[model samples]
Target: MATTGAVPMITLNNGVEIPQLGFGVFQIPPEDTKEATLVALREGYRHIDTAEMYGNEREVGEAVRESGIDRDKIFVTSKLNNGYHAPEAAAKAFEDTLSALDIGHLDLFLMHWPLTDGGYVDAWKAMEEMLQGGRVRAIGVSNFKQHHLNRLFAETTVVPAVNQIEIHPYLAQDDMRDFDREHQIATEAWSPIAQGKVLDDAVIERIARRTGKSPAQVVLRWHIQRGDIVFPKSVTPERVRDNFAIFDFELSDADMSDITALDRAERTGPDPDVFDYIPS
Candidate 1:
């Protein structure tokens, strides 16, 4: 279900239709984000993904505000930094995020990474409070595996609405996708193009050649056809627009299988399950 100019929405667990294909500015320099995000907006991307750790929420917000697009028409997602795991600290973190973005209510708020400090329960509780307070429209987890999600589910009745993870052909994560499907949680793909690693794959290249699309577009199209909400980040305005141009084409069944066959369990980002993250 490719969303044309119709905002390309995906129904979130909370009944919010998030754009299935969105723009991401991860790792973009903070100083360069405003112009980049504004370029994305002009290119017809209605959804934007950012994080407190990214240190560019203000720039994203500034770009959104300057775009002159109606607030209701755009969906923005931000994550809580690892340092704010305490329940009491969660509220402050959200407030800080809102202040940085200068937005009224968050479309989605997620735990950036499940830190080893064991503030997740407190963090979840704080997110619940914010949800109730109308500060965040929905709550979710990021980079969390089944164990972390299970731990959270065991403590809270409100299941996470979404799980944003590093997903691409190299790391398909079928188990995680199955878990989300059974639990009614939406799986969002970060680094949906495998950080461009799969571009040179023989299978991926074949599909791209057959489909008349770039390898990146072919991979992103595979993610979307596989029922994953993908946010592929690019700083170049032309690339940003080109990334969103996947809607016009569809991958055949053979193309889908060939792309899926490229899964190698390879992961590009840090594994949230085990990482000695020391906050700066």
Candidate 2:
């Protein structure tokens, strides 16, 4: 039996504990999501992050059920799609996610994106209601900048348990991460490797060689050392196994700083404040 202690846990502001390292299912085609997720579970990943936008929640749920792990042993996270930011739509979307995942309750649910024009405050209200209703253990926001989070703070009574964002060596998002820490909101890094863009950098390559770890492992260890929750996506079985193997090593303080200095404010995803387009 795989113990839940394989990965460290970060307690959220609301007292919900989540695995610091998890599996992300983004851009993974729905057809293959099940097998990939099952592989992750078998590899000892207790947390699984997926979103409605990814169109693979059902398959993720299937993987969970078929993995034969106890429901309480795995932590599952899903997000609201952009088009469903309205309060009513948000409520329905939550139910739909539950039905699709068939997990009975969600471990953590987040707003996929802060659609500024889409009444996110109201959507958050519905999320609060979801939490109060006992369907979700924790609620949070994704791709929300400091200002976006400030708006939620002003308009809502519940503080988000997390703020999932695009974070990699190239785009460290230091200021936003600091804000989340100050507010006791856990930060989750989505593209922790910058979609493989930073794996080939000279500095990262040097650290990888010195640590005798792959570039991917070095970068992921950086996120872990910085105390950010990260979920790297990979459909390939070997890569998935490799990603979960990051817990054994430690990076030197200088190596950590060297990687941190690689932040160039580059982003592989859209800026939250300016991104409002919903796919049609």
Candidate 3:
């Protein structure tokens, strides 16, 4: 069995440590989330990324409890949904997340999006309060572009500990990753596989053939070599275990560059800057 020690830890700007590799529960139905999350936990994935919008925090919480791993040993992250950007609404939403997860406190909490609606600044303020109150160990923003982060820095005092964005070999996002690095903010890659779109690419396939790894594994290794944190979502038990097995190998510099050269700036998810839809 793999142990937590096998996973590399990345320290946040505020000194909180997170597993560089984790399990993400996005687009997972509530009923299946518990089983899939349990598989991940048992497979030695100590970090779990989830969002309130995913509507499965309760299941994630259930899995955490059932896994019998010490709560303190697990790094759990959840995000405030898009509709709850107002200060009061954000506060209530966070409280709801805590209740839903049934976890005493969150390891990390994020502003799910930089909503164009005028309330995001206030939402950030709420997150600041959550941090000071000790409800969350670290705070961050997801889907924030460089300009969005610039505005956030101007309006807030606590720099976000992380900026979670869409990154994959096909959409390397080098500039955004560099910007996050310059500001001491950790870059967390969501849709790290390009939603399976890059899995069939010839470049990634060639790297996979040479490395004796799956195309998904090669792409994941590329993200790891680039110093970006990634959590690939998979409901399959074998895949859950396979994803955790990446720490055993390293990617060559040339292979890393070749995979990086495949970037076309494509995104499988919404563009953060212009996406402002709030689901009902």
lDDT per prediction? Answer: 0.87, 0.92, 0.91
For model 2 the local lDDT of residue 5 reads 61
Which sections of candidate 1 miss by over 4 Å?
Answer: 1-7
> For candidate 3, which ten residues in a row score worst on lDDT?
1-10
Return the TM-score for candidate 3, rounded to 2 decimals.
0.97
State each candidate's clash count: 0, 0, 0
Per-residue error at 75 for model 1, in Å?
0.2
lDDT of 1: 0.87
Query: Which runs in model 2 stand beyond 4 Å of their true positions?
Result: 1-4
Which model is ahead, 1 or 3, in terms of TM-score?
Answer: 3
Cα-lDDT of candidate 2: 0.92
Pairs in clash, predicted candidate 1: none
Q: What's the lDDT of the predicted structure labeled candidate 3?
A: 0.91
Model 3, 94-137: lDDT tens per residue?
Answer: 99999999979999999999977757788999999999999899
Residue 50 C-alpha lDDT in model 1: 98
